[model samples]
Target: TQLLEQSPQFLSIQEGENLTVYCNSSSVFSSLQWYRQEPGEGPVLLVTVVTGGEVKKLKRLTFQFGDARKDSSLHITAAQPGDTGLYLCAGLPSGAGSYQLTFGKGTKLSVIP
Candidate 1:
């Protein structure tokens, strides 16, 4: 079974600051996805990386897939209070046929205004 691990299980920062969070796995993935969830709400898909070494940007946030497709990172610049939430990383194993995904323990971020 493939497992994804995220670092710094929780974080607190002030608005306007920048932070980076990481997701890693021992196995290669066919694709990796990042999601953000707010209290009492389902996680919202932020981005998906399919190609190794690919980088995607969403407003103030940037997502990058490692060259080996075994790791990824999310970077937020000039964070705002609205950015406070739980960040989750999920991955589809390279040869998996089903839609099953391996998820990492989420990182909860609190942005102080």
Candidate 2:
């Protein structure tokens, strides 16, 4: 079984602050994805990283995949209150043969204005 562990399960910061969260796993993955979710809504896909050391940026958010494909990170720059939500990291293990995604516990972010 593949499992992902996310650090600092919850985060609270003021608007304009920057934060970085991590997702780690013992298993190697073929691809990893990040998502953001709001109250009463399903998670929205933010970015997908397939190559090792690949980085993708969306406005103030940045996503990076580790060189070994066993970890990933999300960094937010100058976060806003509107950025407050649940952030999730999911991975597709290599040769899983199924479409099931292994997800981290998730990080709940609260940006106070």
Q: At residue 82, give the lDDT of candidate 1.
A: 95
RMSD (Cα, Å) of candidate 1? Answer: 0.8
lDDT of each: 0.95, 0.95
How many residue pairs in model 1 have overlapping backbones? 0
Model 1 lDDT vs. the true structure?
0.95
lDDT of 2: 0.95
- Model 2 per-residue lDDT tens digits across residues 7-98: 87999999999999999999999999999999999999999999999999999999999999999999999999999999999999988485
**Model 2 misplacement above 4 A:** none
When summed lDDT is taken over every stretch of 10 residues in candidate 2, the lowest stretch is 94-103
Q: Per-residue lDDT tens digits of candidate 1, residues 67-108?
A: 999999999999999999999999999883757888899999
